[model samples]
Target chain A: MSVATADGLTLAGRDRRFGLLLTAPGLLSLLIVITFPLFFTLYTSVHDYTLLTPNYDTFVGTENYQEALDEEYLPGSLWVTTKFVLASIVIEFIIGFAVALSLHATRRFGSIYYLILLAPLLINPVVVGLLWRMLLHSELGIVNYTIGLVGISPVSWLGDADVAFWTVVLTDIWHQVSFMAILLVAGLAALPREPYEAARMDGASTIRCFIHITLPLMRPVIAVAILLRLIFAIKTFDIIFIMTKGGPGTATDLISYYIYRAAFFGLDVGRASAMAAGLLVIILALTAYLYRYMNSLK
Target chain B: MRLFLSVVAALALAVSAAQAQTIRILMETVPDTRYIQELLPQFEAETGIEVEIEAISYIDMHSKLVPQLIAPEGSYDLIVVDFYWVGEFTKAGWLMPLDDLVERDGVDVDVYVPKLMDLVGRVNGVLYMLPFYNYSMALIYRQDLLDDADEQAAFQEAYGMELRVPQTWDEYWKQVEFFTRDTDGDGNRDLYGTVIQGQRGDCISMQWANYLYSQGGLYHDENWNPLLDSPEAIRAMEYYREAVEKYSPAGSEAYCFDEAFNVMAQGRAYSFVTFNILYAGFEDPESSEVAGKVGITPNPGGGLNGGWGWAIPNSSPNKEAAWTFMKWAESAAVAKERAMLGGAPTQAQIFTDSDVVAARPYYPILGEILAGTKDFPVFTYTTEFVEQVGLELNLAATGEKPVAEAMAAAQEKLHALLVKDGKIEE
Candidate 1:
């Protein structure tokens, strides 16, 4: 009886086949565009194929990987990237949290306030870079002029390594906080109001209520936001590049910019692919950890 | 109903019969669409073709073009590449040689300025791209400030010459110091000695290469070995660093071409070194504070050499059309038009055009400069070498490392690269 039933076509099997057919187009598109290119890049990492000399390509297995690990350029750029990502995400999270709390406190004009807070995120990154560059010009820009009025000497926002790095982080935070704030606002809104009300009835202080109730409830959302922002921040190229091009030194040269310089300017495709592979592994590992942590919160 | 629908479909097909060919050209300079505004209509009428001109900032355009060329895809029919990029473009086979087009079309390449033409057109005895516009760096200053200082006689006494316009590096710096003072006595220093680019990128390389070339330095020696750490090259690098530290803006290390231009034009900086392309902006009264007051001279030399020429890409699909456009664009008539529009023309004759000379008195001297301008070595790795040296120079300027040590390090890196590329024997 079991053999006869197995040999016959069943409704559940037909339904599964239909579902697979429906999803094939989407899956194929992903394979062609994303999955194929990703695997190709991984393969290229172990080969020597400078774009200029495509004919002279060869499989120099693991050499490119070893070279990237030992190269001073890669290490210097990685250090800059770590500092940029850590600083940008930490500041954005703090500011975004504060903004979220304030918005939650306000009942009137909440929608309008949110719309205004989200304005920085709406602007294009390159345009933001150009606009901020103009504002920060030492002689002709208004930023320096405003500081001058306060009796502070004009500061070079983009001309010094230390200052330029902070300025880039500041600009990244300015854009990212808006996004994080919106996420935090959702997290705050989703939270049960009864806990705060009960805590109020018990004569618990507002700070105590926040620390005990609000913070714990918002943890998962905060983790997701940080994880997403951290990954995006690590690959920052457009704004920092437009603003400084990793200038004054290699201070703002992130991993993405380094990979670009290696492939395009340095004309070393194999090394760039290897560097990119390094970034991919790190991001995937971190993402996995974050996902697990978020699931644990539930 | 079927017969009526068939008739309607036939009419739609007829309407769509007029073929419209699309052509895209990428350009870095934001030319007023009006210059070619009339020409497009005539071309479209004759050929039934549509033209799309996508103008991008110079840095952005080059960055985009580099990746596209590596793939050798014909995304653009015409592209404007710089003189330095010609080597990389040709050697990589991203560009198509145009000697056949020139011979078949009877193009008078001789009509273009000889040096500009040679720099852009030739690569290993083959014609790659045609030169478009030519530009050279110049010393721009405020004449009224110089006149008021009355330090011409003082300069003559010290240097045994009258300081009409600085002709040497030493005199130029001295003038920057002399004029950079508080004239209003308002406790606030309203003026600076000079402002020049110090950024560790293309702008710094562009400005500093002139000085490097002037000091008898070469990117590659006769043996094709990268000589970025040579004595002459180090001296040139030292000169640029000292100038920035002594006279330029406080955060001069990040200055680019635009910053240097704004400094002199806004009256914050007494003098600046900038490209002749900025003359139009410097001359506009609405845009500049020192419009009529700005004066220009040949960039003071440690010896004498500097400037840029345009080039065509080897990957151009429309070689014939490109060559035709280039020749027409650089012709005497067009050069005169370009001059009147405040563009620097390549021709020597255009400088002497009465209208051009009257509007821009420095046009004549600019011709002399362009005539004498030397080309940076044509190598596939020119950009990388410049970038490395620029980084090292910036490090030295910021006092992060000793100049000799930084130069030596850059030299070692570049040597390894050259040796690896097989441009130089190990």
Candidate 2:
């Protein structure tokens, strides 16, 4: 019995080593690509570093952070980002949920419908922005011309300050709704039909059945969808950069665009890093609150 | 066995020859890129240096090149520098001075237009770049509309001035106001008087600078105190706002260079002020509705001095080879050849070349404008200055803020920036 125990211990130790070996490459890549940059950004946030004048760098603890707080455009950009994220995510969720339900319910021609719905996802975000920029143009755009046929006057979709923000939100929704719909559709397909059928037999209407049965079961999936979309929508840059360019005035200048201008245009790496750190903290707090809510739902 | 040895020897020699040398160039996506591409084969043949060109949009070029320049070693051997970025690039020590190369190559630096040379090639009396192309803004107008007898009579009756190309800002405004009428009697007005580059980026600021400088307003005094809040500057800002809000197209608030040029080219707008490089686009029968009907004149508000130059970055390992290419490209003969190929000419002689003048009727006027062009303030913080001022100008154009308030805010921000940069005392 003592000899057998010694052999078994050796075998278990060897297995543990093999498992670690398998994951070593991934772990090393994460350390180099993710962890290093994160720490470097944090370090930079405390320095007075500008790439144009590298010799001028010196330790300035908390000074950059203080300046970020006092920045004139910070609050406005944050507000714009929040509004963009919420509006795009909410509208995308509703439309995506509806489309997912219909796709799941249809037994015939569902594959073709799914293909058609997923086509926009294949396009890059920058291309989508440029494509929509032309389409929404007041003078030469096909969209305005089409609407003009119905006696509607041309709308300055990307020109007017008041209207440009919503145009950006709508463009984002158009490009991203397919991603949400595809995820939700997979979730809907995985759900067992037993609970939904049981609710139906108990005289529950369709909406009630969905609320009590489908929705409750879909809580985990919905949480994941919402969180992923929130992360992506909050950091939106390319679309705004290519399309409106935070334009007319500062109507569409989201936090990410502002940070980009700070880092690249202003060449103030320290201040941009500080703003990035602030953004990370906000994201962490929001993520923690969301995870807690998701757990409670489960 | 003997034949096999000979073939192997020949292959080895070829590979070694091919690997001898290579130089990479980074440039903006413009007509000059195509002209250079067409001219590069001859240079490669003569010098036996492999050349690779990467051309990207103007904004992307800056973003990509600046980071590379900040690194110890960059990927590009030669880069195209915008006239406005000369101060920034020189301040950062990113560019290598070309005085030695010019002396060694026996380059005639005097061949280039003096004003353009001063604007882009020399910074603080040091030659860091070679002028490659000029984009001095010129007034492009509808010659047919201006020559119309009825329109001229109506304009004289309304504004009490000869309906000719404007010579001053006030006259320009009157022309815009008088010509903003429906030529086709459509209930919906399709024709606009003029177009303005009012987009919230560098377009508005650069366009506004023409008005600002021509009105005797300076961006900064000798002590670096901002003059944007002065009455002359305020009047210029107000005039720019009025041009966008009242005279330009309905959606002119979002018009950049492309949109503004398109409006004029499509005959939907009467005139605009833009870079002379756009003469090709306006003259092309394929892209323009008023191809032969356009006239070029000196921009009313002394056009913004703008151009690009070739500079060797300090990080470049092949600086000598890059300098060879730069000197060769900017030589008078090459400049004239490029001019004939639709590239903007930097040398004065290229403007008088028979083939170039025949190809472009505005070459003479472009030369005159390039000779007298005034540039934006040369300083390390010019980018920041343009960006902050552009934002405020856009706000005023869009009616988000009053002109005075916008200019005041811009002045305050600029003062803070200058003080922070050690350009001025607090």
Candidate 3:
């Protein structure tokens, strides 16, 4: 018995070592690509560096961060980003849930409907932006033209500061809502029908059944969907870049776009790095809150 | 054994002979790219240097070039530097000075138009680039509309002056107002008087500068003090807003050069003030609805001297090969060839060349505009200044803020930026 136990212990230790050996390459790669950039950005945030004049690097600890705090556009852009993320995610979720419910209820031609809904998700975001830009053009677009037939005057969708923000949000939803719908549809399909059936048999209405049985069970899936969309929507750059370019007097200039303008257009690397660090902190805090909420749901 | 060895030696020699010197060029996706691509085969035949080209949209060119330039070794051997970037590029020491190469090769730098050379080639008395193409703003209008006998009579009656191509800002605005009326009496308005490049960031800034400079307003005095909040600057901004609001298309607030030029070329707008390179697009029958009806004039206010030049990056390993390519591309013969192939001519002689003049009748007018074109401030902080001013101008044009308020804000922002850059005292 003692000899057997020693052999088993040796086998278990060897297995653990082999598993670590297999994961070592992936871990090193992640450190090089992700961890290194994160630390470098943190380091750069403290230095007075400009890409144009690289020879003038000097250690100016916290000056960049202090300057960013004073910049009018930084806070404005952060607020814009927060508003856009919350508004887009909520709207996308509601509309996506509705579409998923509709698709799930349909028994005939459901696959065709599902495929059609998935088409927008497959399109490149930049292309979607350009497509929407043409479609929403005040004078030339078919969207305005079609609406004009119903006695609507031409509306400056992208040119008006009042409307440009919502236009961008709507365009984003149009492009990404399909993704949310697909995720929710899969979640709806995987749900155990027993509880819903029992609720229905007990004279519960469709809405009540959904609220008490379906939603409670789908909480984990919804949480995952929301978290994923939040992560992507916070870093939204391509669509805003292609469509409005954060224009109409910075109505839709989200934090990411502001950071890009600072880094690339302004060439103020230190300030841009500081802005990037600020964004990293915001994302980390939101992710932590989301992870806890998701765990609670589970 | 000897025969086999000789065959092997011959193969080695052939391989070495076929290994031609190659250079990579990064440039904007303008008509110049097409011209260069068509001219490359001949250049390769004459000199066995293979050229690889990467052309991107104008908006992306600067961002792409800056990163490559900042890298330890740049990816591009030759880069096309926009006029506004000359100061920044030179200040950063990213460009290789071409004086030695020009002296060694006896390249006649005098052949390029003097104003263009001044605008793009030189910074602080040092030549770091060679002017490749000119994009000076020119007044493009409908010759047919200008020559309309009844319209001219009505215009004279209404404005108490004979209607012709405007030579000043007040007359330009007057003409814009006169031409803004409906021509067809069909209740629906199809044509606008003019189009403004009012897109928020870059276009409006350049468009407004023409008016500002025409009113004798300089961005800075000799001491680099902020002069953007002066009365003349406010008047310029106000005039720009008036033109866009009163005479431009419904969506003119979002119009950039491409949209403004399209409105003119499609015969929906009576006139447009934009870059000279757009002449090719306006003349292309396939793309333009008013191909032969177009006329070109010197921009009423001094035209904006916007163009690009070819520079060898200091990090480029193939400096010699790149220099050779630049010289060949800028040669008078090649310049004329490119001009005939729809490229804007940088060489003064190309404007006078019979074939080029015949192909583009306004070549002389272009030459005149190039001679008198005014450039944006060429300073290290010029990009930041342009961006801030552009944002404010866009706000003013969109009616988000009043012209005076926007100009005041722009002035304050630019002053702070300059102080931070150590260009001015606190």
Candidate 4:
């Protein structure tokens, strides 16, 4: 069944063998890093795996998932997580797109501007949280003191629950808006000049051109950028950990941190794993929905 | 020539293998760990065993250490266990009892403060660790302010009482309201009465535990039923809330130990309830603006007994080596040396050392504090309990939840957990 070619080797079989050999390392690494851990989490989710007594002997199928669902704080954590993710993503996207448009129109030293815009993103999230915590301290921080000097009252940045959630969201936006801006700017730069030229020749307004040409053409890039931010936003941990710690009565209790509390503080690794797996499912579903919607737009 | 080379290479290999057999310790980021780091060279010179330390903050230590302990062959040979966690780890079989090792080695356990030893040395009659240092809580006040004649007169006029160390919760509150005022007449209230550790988790839990105790709140009954919803417990939580909302600094509702200590150390606040180990940090002229003027005493009603201990994990490969390090570190000479370096003195005898006393005048007060100090409740779910209770306290402090509702909710949840753990009936 082999078709022989040069040097007494079958062309199709030899080509296929070489291709497999070339891609083996990549596939193997993918399996090891991603596939194995995913399956392990699923497996652990079904068992009574606790850090206290880590073993697989106890097979409590779906018990962990049921308990996690039944837990009182689970709803609150999910609600907070949804709010934080939405606020961070929506605000970041709007600001990022605006900055990206401004940068695209810039005629000067663009790299200096990029360096300025990327400064917060360049800092580690941990450092960002700490820097903001100090800067926003109600009594001692420069922010409150400066504001106070101008007759504004001190704002409890991380103390009051309503204020705390928004404070965290703003801090996140400050750290992450740059990412979206840079990504959108790249998308804007890569857009075709031909369509815009056509629109200009047609005497279309800039806003009309932007709506008709830019939005339709840049849809994929926007989709990808927003999707990535959505995924990252859902898993946000460092800011909450360093700043609010899911506190002021579970006001900022993101699901990720709640799972962490379950695993570490509660010592219930199985329940945490189930929660993680559920989050993974939710993320996948959201991604699929977004992808379908993007395709529909096209 | 080849034979001669073989003999030399074999000897080198053996020596290198011996040298590689070293012990590692996991510790909390505290001054005692710093003391150990400085003395590592001496320990190595004496025992010919190299040592390594990985220290982290209290918030991260539990999660980081637990994973390692789960491994059959642990990465660390020695670990510093906070007493609250000793019971949990021991029950899980993650730690090895050291009674036989202590007896065989003739280690003098009596050298340590008995209260500390009782707190961390054993779990259900099995000796699991050696005391490292004491962190028994104390109330630190500005001694200079108390002694000022003008301030006394002002205080007398304001409250019709002599200014002295607060002896009751009522006294503490009155002092808080009276002392918290504009210090420099800038219209911004500069001086607070005291500072609070009202941050989300461990900080608030550890701080409020003292208040809860003094006001007759217990974490649970003997039958493991949560008693947090009782009247006394609610009162205690209300008092803590008032301290944050009405009397303390503008942002005292969200503070960790460092923030509280800094407020007191900068002389912006008049008093702070904190670990006894902080006396040195307060007295350090470089760190504290009020150095040599701060005074320590037992909190108005009670203090919390707390500290860490050194233990070898069951999974550690270097058990004997770890024990050797413990013995060396806890030895009379080494302990005294650590005390001299402003380490929290765990050994009873070090408190009486004239030189040590001269260096740390607050040790006697700590000794008195120790007399009535109580350890935070220990049970199968101590860490979780603290976190849950701490969250409630923070919520009540911030006025996010009514104190009674928060306590009731905490009790309800904890009762459910106790039932799940089989500690109580449904």
Interface-residue RMSD per candidate?
Answer: 1.7, 1.3, 1.5, 1.4
Per-residue alpha-carbon lDDT of candidate 1 for residues A188-230, written as tens digits (9 for 90 to 100): 9999989999999999998999899999999999998999898
Chain B TM-scores per candidate, in order, are 0.86, 0.93, 0.93, 0.94
Index of the highest-DockQ prediction? 4
Docking class for model 1 is medium
Can you tell me which runs of candidate 1 are displaced by over 4 Å? Answer: A1-23, A55-57, B1-22, B30-50, B67-73, B149-161, B184-188, B214-216, B302-319, B353-359
Per-residue lDDT of model 2, residues B193-237, tens digit only: 788888787888877887786687878888888888999999988
Ranking by lDDT: 4, 2, 3, 1
Once model 3 is optimally superposed onto the true structure by TM-score, how far is the C-alpha of residue A160 displaced, in angstroms? Answer: 0.5
Better of 1 and 4 by lDDT: 4
How displaced is residue B211 in candidate 3, in Å? 1.9
In angstroms, what RMSD does candidate 4 have relative to the true structure? Answer: 2.3
Q: What is the DockQ ranking, best to worst?
A: 4, 2, 3, 1
Q: Give the per-residue Cα lDDT of candidate 4 at B237.
A: 91
In every candidate, how many clashes are there?
A: 3, 0, 0, 0
DockQ of each: 0.57, 0.64, 0.58, 0.66
Task: Report lDDT (CA) for all predictions.
Answer: 0.75, 0.85, 0.84, 0.86
lDDT of 2 at A155: 88
Query: Residue B213's C-alpha lDDT in candidate 4?
Result: 75
Ranking by TM-score: 4, 2, 3, 1
Residue-wise C-alpha lDDT for candidate 2, range A112-229, written one tens digit per residue: 9988988888889989988997788666678988998887888888779989999999989988998999999999999998888788788899999888888888888888899999
Cα error, candidate 3, residue A122 (Å): 2.1
Cα RMSD (Å) per model?
Answer: 3.5, 2.6, 2.8, 2.3
- Compose the digit string of candidate 4's lDDT tens values, residues A130-180: 899889877778898898889987887887888889999999999999999
